[model samples]
Every structure is written in C-alpha cells, then in structure tokens.
Target: MATTALFFLFAGFAIACAVSMVYHRNPLYSAISLVGVFIALSCIYITLAAPFIAAVQILIYAGAIMVLVVFVIMLLNLEDDKPLNRLRYLYAVGGGLGLILLVQTFFIFYAVMRAPKQTVDADVTVGKTLSIGTAMYTEYLLPVEIVGILLLMAVIGGVILARRLEQPKLELVVDNELERRGEGEIKDEFRIRL
Candidate 1:
C-alpha cells in the first residue's frame, strides 16, 4: 500500500513537472522543471527497489546534465518569446503505432507465459545488492565505466561551451575634424566634403 501510494505521488509529480517543462515560456524555468521531473523519476525508481538505477538517474540526469542545461540556458540569455511549436505529424504517428505494437507484444507474451505451479521460498533469495553488484561488475563493468566517462566528457564540454566569451563589437568614433574634412569612411561608404 505504501509503495503504491508513493508510486502514485512520484508519478504525478513527474508528469506535472514534465508538462511544466514543455509549456513554460522561460527557458530557465523550463530547465528547472525538467530537473524536478528527473528527480521525481529517480525517486520512483528507488521505490521500485532499483537502487543502482536510481543512483545513476540522480547522479547523471538530475545532478550533472540538468545543471549543464541550466547553465547553458542562462549563459545564452535566452528570451521566452519563441516556443518550439514545430510538430512533425508523421513522427508522432509512427511513434504511436510503435507504442501500440509494443503493448500488443507484451500482452501476447503475458498471456502465453504459464504460471509456475511450485511454491517459492522468499528467504532463499540472495541480497539485492550482492546479486546486482556481481552481475553489473562482471558482465557490464566496461560499458558502465565507458558511460561514466562519456557523461564526464559531456559535462566538461557543456561548461566549456557555456563559458565561451562573446565577441567584442568594434565602435567607429570619427573626430569632428575628420567629419568636417569628410575623411571618415563609414564602413566602405565615404562622403565628399561640400
């Protein structure tokens, strides 16, 4: 009951924040909302007993990636006037069709899988971290390290891009004597003295 209640709470918060992220006009606000959504999703994953996934979600998505997004948005000084309203109906239709097919496949599998008639003992189950850690380190260690390195690179890249200096604009200030003599050339346009 507690799990179900927590699931619903986190699920609702995640969906609400996701919607806010899409609809908010301010880029900073949208980025913050997206971070909120990611954090809520991480909580939901934790409630599902997937601690490793939850840790990764919080560490990578909510912590590093969202911070980069927020920094980039702020550094760009983005205005809120334009919203990304361009929608590709074909992509949407294809995605909907794919989701429907995936749901159908799941239902078919669930129907075909027969229930085990044997009684199971819960006490024999290995500790969650022990089994999961063994599998991840032995089978998926390389990929996991590679992903971490990629994420670190992305963070460094984002910081570099965001902190890039803006080009300085040159100002042309011609003196009064030069103006009177018509010696000043206004960016390739010269005027003759009358």
Candidate 2:
C-alpha cells in the first residue's frame, strides 16, 4: 500500500511537471520544469526498485543534461517568442486527444491493478553495473557505438552553427531597382531586404 501510494505520488508529480514544462512560456522555465519531471521520474524508478536507473536518471539526465540545457539557453540568450494565443486553434483540437489519453491511462492502471504479481527469476542477474557494462560492450556494442557517433555529429553540428558568422550583404536600391552589393562594400541602403 505504501509503495502504491508512493508510485501514484511520483507519477502525479511527474505528470504535473511535464504539463508545466509544456505550458511555460520561457525556455528556462520549461527547462526547469523538465528537471522537476526528471526528478519525479527518478523517484518513480526508486519506487519500482530500480536503484541504478534512478541514480542514472538523477545524475545524467536531471543533473548533467539539465545543466547543459540551461547553460545553453543562457548562453544563447533565448527569449519567449509570441504568445500562445496564436495556437489557440490547436488547443481546441488537442483537447479531444487529451481526453483519449486520460481514458487510456485509466484503463492501463485498472489492468495493472487486476494483474497477478510475478516472481523474479533468481537465476537472472539484473541491475548490476558489471552485468550491464558487459552486456553493453558485448551484445549492444554496435548500437552504443552508433549512438556515440550520432551524439558526436550533433555536437559538431552545434559548433558549426555557433561559429557561422554570415553577415548578410545589404541589397542596394539604386534607381528603385534592387542591386546585390559585395559583402565588403558598405552601402547606404539601411533597409535590409529580408
């Protein structure tokens, strides 16, 4: 009963955080909400008796990755775009989907409550760092290598985008006709033809 209550508590907290993350206007606030969601998920993992996954969820996702995301948001000096009223139509459509999801969640919980508990196999080693590392290196080596490569590529792409200093050459309006000026040339056409 205690475990079930804890699970529900963390699950509700996680859902609230997720909704807050989506509802926030500011990127930083959204990111902070996401951190809360991650922490709640860590608590859920704890309730499920997965200490290793819980620790990883807190350390890697909640700690390191959130810090990076917040740092990047600060570094880029991001601001909230337009208000959400522009997407009011989408919300009306999404309400139906949200109702469906709620019903599905209720049915899932009902099924879980009615399901029989299964005994863990004593022969199978689970949640050990050594066993996980062995499996990652032996069985999932290619997939792990591929993920690493993808992450590396993403980092490289981010660096390239950050270093791009493309100064747009001002379009010169000579005789009411647009003329492409050289990048080095400084013309009096202050109106940037965007």
Candidate 3:
C-alpha cells in the first residue's frame, strides 16, 4: 500500500537523519540533519492522513526550530568541536542491555494498559486544520504562547550576542601637529612596507 510504503520511507529517513545529527561534528551540519529528521516526521504524519499535524511538523519543527538552531550555530561560530568519542566496550554493552530492558518494560506496561478501541461517528475528520486549531487555541493556547515567547527571547539573545562591538579609538586627533612633533621634523614612518 502507498501509506505503508511512505511510512517506511519516512521512518528510515528520520532514523538516518537523527543518527547523522548526533554523529556529525559540524554544528551547522547537525542542524541541517535535524531539519531533515523533522521533515521526515512530517512526511510520516502525511502518510498517516494527518495533514494538519504534518503542516505543524513542517512549520514548527522543520521551519522554526531548525532555523533557530542554525541561527544560534552561526551566531556562536561553533565549528571547532570534534565528533564524539566511541564508547568503551563495557559501556556500550551495558547501554545496549539497559535499552533492551527499558523497551521490554515499556511494552509490558503498554500491553497491560491497552484499551479496546471505541467506535466513533464516521463523520469526524481526523485531519481537519480548523479542528486542530480550535483544539490548540482552546486547550493548549497558554503553552503555545509561552513557547513562542521563549523562542522570541532566544532570538533576541542570539542577536545581542552576535552583534559586533564598536571599534576602539585608534588615536586622538591633534589640531596642530607642531605641538606634538618638532617643527619641520620629517615624519618618515609612512614608507610602504613592501
């Protein structure tokens, strides 16, 4: 099916980008990979027939968040950091075991808490933009506004940090050079250094 194929494609791309984001040494490259991951997530939403969610994923995650990250990277000029060191063998083994156990516990809890799907009216639009907007404004407006303000503050801070400082005064102007230098004394220091 088209949906299944798209789902797999997006999922693979998302995983690739996420891995690249983590492993890339360049901050700008990592930000770009993160944008790719966000876009792949948006595609997954589209495959699920949730166009509203897809749009938000594209607009907020890929657009706003990625831009902010890129801007911060540019502002900070952070290009010197090296890639992460490979983990030690014991640490890697332990982490793998811990991850497996965590996943197992999550599945067990999910299975225990699983609920039967209830039938709903067939007329409901699962991906309606208007409905999503209404819900967000009604239920999550405060949180959304707070996040927006935080982003604005971050942008302002970045701008302030990135601003260039005024050049320091080089030399004080002398109205009459005769006072500083003896009259008729040849100032020969202007010779070209070539």
Q: State every prediction's TM-score relative to the real structure.
A: 0.56, 0.66, 0.58
Candidate 1: Cα lDDT at 159? 95
Kindly report which residue stretches of model 2 are placed more than 4 angstroms away from their true locations once superposed. Answer: 75-83, 110-115, 121-126, 165-194
Top of the candidates by TM-score: 2
Give the TM-score ranking, best first.
Answer: 2, 3, 1
List runs of model 3 lying over 4 Å from the truth: 83-126, 137-194
**lDDT per residue, candidate 2, 24-141, as tens digits?**
8899999999999999998987666567778998999988999999999999989895667677999878998999999999999999999999876533445546667888999999
Deviation in Å, model 3, residue 120 alpha carbon: 7.2
Relative to the true structure, candidate 1 reaches a TM of 0.56
Q: What are the lDDT figures for the candidates, one per model?
A: 0.77, 0.81, 0.77
Expressed as tens digits, the lDDT of each residue in 1-194 for candidate 1 is 99899999999999899889877889899999999898998898777666667788889998898898989998999988563367667668878997998899899888768655564344333324666778778999999899999999998998999885653233223344456677655533532322
- What does the lDDT read for residue 104 in candidate 3? 100
Q: Which tens-of-lDDT digit does each residue in 15-100 have in candidate 3?
A: 89988997788889988999999899988877666788889889888888779789989999996565447655766797899799
Model 3 weakest 10-residue run by lDDT: 167-176
Q: What lDDT score is found at residue 179 in candidate 2?
A: 37
In model 2, the number of clashes is 0
